[model samples]
Target: MGYGLAVLGLLLVLSGAPAPAQTRAQTQESNDAAEQELRLPPIGSPAAEAMARYAIEREKKEYRENIERAQEVARLSAELQKAFEQRHGLFPDDLRKLERIEKLARRIRSEAGGSDGDDEGSDLPKSLEQAVRRLANVAKDLSERVEKTPRQVISASVIEKSNELIELVRLIRRLS
Candidate 1:
């Protein structure tokens, strides 16, 4: 072989380019990388391992969730305001003034939440299907809390998007 070819052949033999052998350390490293990606705890650790647990916990029990929920409520309120303006050039005269409507909105929202702990499943009105869907999603999320591991995390930042959807539901209910 030529000098270059000789060197190439020697390098290929040393590198085992024709055949592959995975060392134990290389295998362990690959496994570790996978575990990290999955948020799995090490062989021996006291703390929780998975990120999903944190996400579920943060979304409900944390202040971040409350803020997000409050923001969603604000967005729904804005949409209702806009729809009212579009429909009647400001709020309806019979719906009461802004301040009173705000008070009623708070009362009703609190009542809705408080009523969740009660027997709401039996008394949901058939006419409020749209409202029920939105509220069902909220309940679905809130009910999925992590009991063992709770940490603050945010999911998808989807409150605004949900707000737009709920706005349509709120409008439908107001009309019905």
Candidate 2:
């Protein structure tokens, strides 16, 4: 009788234990349900429509801001180029322009999805004039690239160019 009772208790305990496969299936189902709950509403639903409109408006605003920053970069670079041509080297007063160019380039780089990181090595310009000229050319290229890129796109080339322009501006600032 004791042996039969012990066997019955063990059977009950074994039956109550959840099987690993069954537990995993339950967890997967729970995860799927949670994911479904977090998903966007179906297309044509009011919530979905509102989300779409908001996304479009936000994209348009970002696009306008990007264009403005790129244009400012071009203008500042051109001014630097002109100053160099006139004086043959940057004057103390021209440091402000370089600072502004650096600021604008930083903003443009961030907006284009770039992070502050060491740029790939390149030969440093031998003179202030050469650096300024390179800066002007790069700024122009950056402006054109930004204008050509669609609002929905994140451009690697634009980010690379911005980094290059920023480094040149910094080098010029330090040398001046």
Candidate 3:
């Protein structure tokens, strides 16, 4: 295997290929250049430029909206965490909060045109599915907590669920 790798390296050197390592700025510059090229109007009409400007502004608006939604999700997850850590144990409001989280997740998935976790041929992305599964796991952990599990175990489970919720919200934010 070492010899094969050496041979491959030699071939790659001979081919004068550029190294794969790139700084973030370099990558961004390349991406920006590509985007600029793609935005060049085919007919070079003033109307085309106007349309491009409109599209760019619309995209900016959509991006801002998505960020707001992501913030809301994160806030909800934090609230859930606080509820889990309450001295009085799980309250009725906690269940209502969980329902809200589920609703937001479904709405996010729906916006991405994913199925509601029921259809056999669901076109949801793997990340979204994983997030949904994490949500389910959190619910299961909550049940365990409600069953009067040891304090340490319940705390640990809550921590894990909180992390999962954050990750799920992050995934939802990257939908666009």
Q: Candidate 2, residues 17-129: lDDT per residue as tens digits?
A: 54444677786798899999999899999999999999999989988998999998998899889989998888766888888888988888888888798365566697888
TM-score-wise, the better of 1 and 3 is 3
In candidate 3, residue 149 scores what lDDT? 32
Task: Give the range of the ten consecutive residues with the poorest summed lDDT in model 2.
Answer: 16-25
Number of backbone collisions per candidate? 0, 0, 0
**Full candidate order by TM-score, most accurate first:** 2, 3, 1
Instruction: Output candidate 2 Cα RMSD.
Output: 8.3
TM-score of 1: 0.25
- What local distance difference test score does each model get? 0.43, 0.87, 0.51
Cα RMSD (Å) per model? Answer: 12.5, 8.3, 19.0
Over the full model, what C-alpha lDDT does candidate 3 score relative to the true structure? 0.51
Off by over 4 Å in 3: 1-42, 87-92, 111-113, 117-176
lDDT digits (tens) for residues 1-176 of candidate 3: 99998998888778865445656788689889999987756666997879878988886665455444444555565665555545334356655665576565444333333443422322333653344445455544433432343322324433333344434544444531
- Best candidate, TM-score: 2
